[model samples]
Target: MSLGLAGVCLALVTAAGATSGSVVFVPVLSFTLAWTHSIEKVRWEEDYVVRPGKTPGAAPVLEAVAARVRGSGAGMEPPPDARLRHGWYEYTPTLRHPAELRLTRSGFTADYDWCTGGRCRSMAGLLPSNGGVTVLTACRSAPP
Candidate 1:
């Protein structure tokens, strides 16, 4: 079954790999000004994160979606910080349990280190097309 946009993986289908043939685009925030909190701090921010699986190599597709989402906001005035970002968006490969990755942009980037207990290392960095996810499982990496 489809989990819709459960957590950050968005609409990850119940299959893994780029070969799965059932790739799906998870939910993306169309509007900005969302609230976020963490040990670091809490505040409202403008950003959108696309939840893509961790199979790797899904960045291109996710980026395309992000462009569309950003495009929707075009013809209007950009926020003060829009100049610094490509599209106020990023792709989340996976969201660890209990250690939730909230709606904060920093949270997404920091989770890379926190979720891995600092031992987590990405050889190629956060791309997209992660291990397929189903209703039974959020986007999960094969347990080591």
Candidate 2:
């Protein structure tokens, strides 16, 4: 079974360099990644778009990452183009195509939240507690 919704698909690669069989997400075309800075303790959110690959059965592409930071402090500097809106600095940072967003689950700070289709779920709830790195990438289908 797949966990993805109706757009793209994703899987979790643990810190041990092994892909977890039960970890998956049937994501939508757009998703928001939210996490807290390890040191700053400030919240940050990034919106991403998953575009289908040109070739059949090929991995999809991830692009258009618009990010926002709650407050700027240590390691939380917003870009010059960032605009303050509702107490958050919103800006669209440049990102290379096929972006691979790697998030570290240190089991110390708050767990990252992946939001889509007006719903939010913690990464910890979607995957096992490995306390390692979880790579979120675009895929055409859920891994077997």
Candidate 3:
């Protein structure tokens, strides 16, 4: 009877583990406007000229944003079939010329690339304008 009881307990533990493991955690993408220097003098249709690579302290900014995102209960586990590794984006704005910079997880991953630049086609094509700093996160979708 003791042996049978032991076996039952083991089975119960195993079943519990399996059930917990099957629970899928979706990845959440987040973005923030590190800094924005307005060019109030720009004329023509261009309301404001956007230049990347200008933030003085970007490392800490990115780290803080990442921490906030993680703390928001967003699953940190990389997608099972995720081609690209999880990473962050660093947008650098300059006076003469600025460019949007991204440090993405290498490979053909499919999470979400948060950006203020035209890097992420999904976001670049459709971003609201207000001349202020902002944070953006990608929403998760089922594997294609």
Best by TM-score: 2
The residue-by-residue lDDT of candidate 3 on 1-144, one tens digit each, is 111100000001122223111212223222332221122211111111222123532211111222111111123332233232233222222222212222222123222233433333322223322222222222122334
Which regions of candidate 2 are displaced past 4 Å?
1-23, 55-58, 142-144
Which runs of model 1 end up more than 4 angstroms from their true locations?
6-28, 34-45, 56-144
Rank candidates, TM-score, best first.
2, 1, 3
Model 2, 1-144: lDDT tens digits are 443333544456655787776646555688888988888889998888888676755567888678899999965689899999999999987774645777778878888887887788886766655677777777644434
Off by over 4 Å in 3: 1-67, 72-102, 115-144
Candidate 1 structure quality by residue, lDDT tens digits, 27-68: 332222223233333322332333454555332112111211
* lDDT value for model 2: 0.74
Cα deviation in Å at residue 50, candidate 1? Answer: 2.5
Ranking by lDDT: 2, 1, 3
Q: What global local distance difference test value does model 1 have? A: 0.29
Backbone-clash count (model 2)? 4
